[model samples]
Target: MTAVRFKPTLLAALMAASLFQSAWAVEPFVLKDIRVEGLQRADAGTVFASLPFRVGDTYTDDKGSAGLRALFATGLFKDVRIQVDGNVVVVVVEERPVISRVEFVGTKEFDKDVLVKALKDIGIGEGQPFDRALADRAEQELKRQYLTRSLYGVEVITTITPTERNRVNVTFTVTEGEVTKIKSIRITGNQAFSESTLISQMDLTKGGWLTWYTKSDQYARAKLNADLETIKAYYLNRGYLEFKIESAQVVISPDKQDISIAISVSEGPRYVVTGVRLEGEYLGKEEEFRKLVTIEPGEAYRADAVAATTKAFTDRFAAFGYAFARVDFRPELDRAKGQAVAVLVAQPQRRVYVRRVNVAGNSRTRDEVIRREFRQFEAAWYDGQKIKLSRDRVDRLGYFKAVDIETVEVPGTADQVDLTITVEEKPTGNLMLGAGFSSAEKFTLTASVKQDNVFGTGNYLGIDLNTSKYNRTIVVSTVDPYFTDDGVSRSYDLYYRTSRPLNTQGGDYKIVTPGGAVRFGVPFTEFDTVFFGAGVEQTSIKGDTGLPVSYRLYRDTFGETSLSVPLTVGWSRDARDSLIAPTRGRYQRLNLELGVAGDTRYLRGDYQFQQFIPLSNRFTLGLNTEVGYGKGLSGKPYPVFKNFYGGGLGTVRGFEQNSLGPLDIEGSYVGGNRRVNVNAELYVPFPGAGNDRTLRLFGYMDAGNVWGEKDSMSFSDVRASVGVGISWVSPVGPLKLSYGKPFRYQDQDKIQRLQFQIGTAF
Candidate 1:
């Protein structure tokens, strides 16, 4: 048996061989035959394919050296030699060992498939060549991954074991120690602002209760860089034009379980904007371009305003098909006077048109569903605003987790580009089963099945079932957004509900209602819609035992069972920035229902308004007002079942559910025909969660009152309450928990100060 030793410096050896060829004169000969040896896994044909010479071809020092270089470059062999025995060329090679298997031991930080993928990405995996260099690279990659997770004390050991048939097995053993957390973060040289104020602008923070989820305490280079940028922006936005981060240092403790960060910054003199001038090409729209400038004279110099002005200019140019436009802001600063003048320069390059539009990354949703949302068309002039609106519209659909648009230049065409829209689809179907405990409902159970994109056709289907002590309901619904192909929507709903007294021990007295409705929504504007619906409802009362006086009287007058045909008209307008956590927007709704001809005749209407104002990046102020009124028509009394109920989660939080308004002879609540409610709330990020909006804390003041048929609605009789609440948008659903205290309450009024509800937002 013979052992082969492959030199590490193969390129150097090949260079030396080239030098020998030039130094010595060797005779060339014609090869009679070619033979390959020392191949266990790789075939001889592979070697022949890589060779520079063949049988009957002239073989010289140049060809021999070229063949060796080619074979070695293939990365399949460790050694190669060419010899001639009486005009017969012979090739001998030592093939590299193949990786038979890859395994990981003691890997808890990441899954085995993840580690294998990481190794495979760097060309070190099963069925690949085994080399020390590749193994070293794999080890370094693994270590880098661990560092990203703040595991400073992690260790990786690679073991290569030889197997039969010139194969080897690779294993990576990982020891993931305690994750190092930031113990303290200190900022120095911040003279203009307090240390606490400056630190509050940073994302990195000390270890706290929320650190486990936010990971702000973890040390990451990327996070540190982002925090530094945020600090700089904060200063620049507050008129500190020359603020700079001098240095940042991170120190790890001896035990590798704790880390500390220190950052030094210099705040220069504050400056006020003296003036803003627009220069360069404006496409003959100087006034329009000037109006886009947000920087005002005699105002504080704000980097954000300057950036906004430049972005506006670029966007305007893009609207005119100038996709390659550039806008630059030149600031002339006078340090002595503490003043600056900003000059905007714009350059509109060649006009380009879109050559094509491509969509990708949508596995469930149909391509037409996404394409219809796009406002930017192919073979048309580029419009940046339209493209951005299209992106936002697609995102608002809520069918995808992420939506991104990219512009790519078309090859060989200077005035043409291609737009690519990429979307990451999310699960649009959900099956939920919920259980909760409340004082009013006691033990409640709920189940729902919904699909927002049924069969990828952009249709919605849902079924809901609720079984509570006070209320039981079952409903099924479906919607089609493109019923008329012009943004018109159609929906149908069928529901059955049974209601009983909340404080009653048994279901003695109950009201049963069954109904179905068909509605159509017509979009008159981008943000407004008008809906019209018609429904038929049947209401029946059963088991007069323990029934309220009002319920019993209504049953006797209406003959126990009643039928009605209702015509409903509604209008809504929404301009929220985000549907889940709106920071700035206004929403308005108006609804009217008329019972034309039935066992009971009634007219009811409601109007609601909501406005959200952003106080800062982490705070928002919200105001909501709702008013309702109802009466009977055609000389008949108002239907008892159509009365409005106030109090509880969606109304006054300090009062018991349905405990407001007129009372029956038995002292039970009989609801009312008129209702008014107003709510004001200030929302802030949850403590220790930084700027995460998924969870928030809010302080709210609520005032509302329900008036009976004869009672007039008055503000003086409205009940008021103040409370604090926590809102968390968890993966399963949204949850609200509040603790309230009534400011005005009587001994006869029922009180429920603590309230919580799941699957709803405050």
Candidate 2:
């Protein structure tokens, strides 16, 4: 190669001449013809269109090089070349095989969607060219995801199908073999606590009746750390002073479904603290901080005590707005005697105050609702506890989907802070549409539209409509929370409904009712609330002919002038970390309804209590109890409209729907004089899985009965049944399927034998 220097005009002309000479050096192959080969999956026309130089085009070094690069970049070929013969450019290509089909075989654990997504993630998707490298990566990733769930020894095979247009279909036939279960757990170097006790601390459990559903038998590495923490806490609480997890090993069986966990623990010598010292300025209030410290001289060197002291100092600094304060413990260890001296160091920087609070992401809720919950106000010293409380308050509003608070320091200012609160709004409206099926009513559809917060103004409005063989309703309701300001939640609702209880044996009864209610909520504490409300109900009985003897008697006595004031008070506490997947929390609700001021009235009350408790990572226990009792006031029999009825899938699954009340004509329930129901359920997960407790096998025991007015509630009349069922939180709502066999039934009682219901909270 030679370098040429020339004037601007000469440079342009000389470059053109040099390019022509170089093109001619390549023999000026004037593509007299073109031939494409080795293209099994691609059309020849498409291949020719992709060529840089087509037929009859003079082949140049640059054009041929560009053609090869373009073909290679398309990823449709393993080899591509361009040959020139007397101006004839031949395009030669070895096309990559196309994928015609994808399939999975013997893969019971993971669904096809899961595998397809995994393959697509790695660029080995269906209908694309098949490359061995991509398939290998896909297989590896699948195995990794499976092994994470303790599924080992899984195999994947690729199957290719030759199809039309030189295209080929590929399938990944996978053999996801049996998942491994825990064989046994062996704990070493433990003397204080028994092996069984330690194993109980671990979420992984041995195979049992519940284990088949919970799959707690599989060993996970993450569970080891949690179990170690439990062991450390246990030993420390018992005065072990120093305990450590030395090593943990999980061995899987050859079948890949069985596993064994071995944990080694080191219980160090216990030490008593000789003394404690404080270093650094404690805001010039040494005495105050000295009193705040929980760790004292001559006390045991407990980790918990040390943590507590650190927290106390940190919180004290935070109270002064020094939220970034650092507290470190320089422990003086006496190795020879195994004793410890605690010296606390604190660095409380300049105090800062909140300058302004900004809220964002609340497109539905009014900004004031979030601002009212904030405790860290402008010009106030920053406090961690107050900020956390503010966050919790925003979360408790139930209007926001998410809430977050972040603090920022103002530039060039030592005592300035800015709080940014971000919140995401959730759908506060509840739309309910229900349909019921039974041997008596056949099928019924019910629907309602309600909004808890309307137009971000904290007002509620709703319309409800329902149609069924036994009942029909159409109502309009509205509520205004800002009626009086001061953060008082007030609600008012009005409604009109009609009911016609199914007459099983030659009876006809129907009633039309109109009512209205007003309620005000009183906030007791962060986790507790009380609501008070009053309502008026009027039920006009029509077509009471051929009705049950009890219903007929009620219509004749009350004459449809049943003006009543329904008084209700409710209390609830929700401490569950999550409304769903609550592993350690408690929720309780109690509702009481009392008839206070109503014509032809009596005193009546309905009570219900629900409790949810998490027994372990894989099990939860839920209990529900309800009782309804009503009687005629001033020696009048109870109104038939207020009478309670039971049975069916939502209640006792082994009994016919609404057949548990007092019998009237030939074994038909005339409506109960009093009602009681109690249900206890235990939910466990499916075997060998993650936290997807979506499908749970549950066992429930239900007991209670409805009785006549003279049949004072007694245990002798209580009917009981135990059943096993499956619960699924389906897309629509909660679905429960129960198969109960009644353990107690009278000779004339009708039983459902087995029942299942969907989309019901009960």
Alpha-carbon lDDT, every model: 0.88, 0.74
**Residue-wise C-alpha lDDT for candidate 2, range 192-270, written one tens digit per residue:** 7898877766667766665665667765677667777877877775556768888888877666767788889998876
Model 1 residue runs over 4 Å out of place are 1-33, 43-45, 54-56, 81-93, 209-213, 409-416, 434-444, 501-506, 559-561
CA RMSD per model (angstroms): 4.1, 10.1
Each model's TM-score, in the order given? 0.91, 0.62
Model 1 residue 319 distance off true place after TM-score fit, in angstroms:
2.7
Per lDDT, the best of the predicted structures is 1
Q: What's the lDDT for candidate 1?
A: 0.88
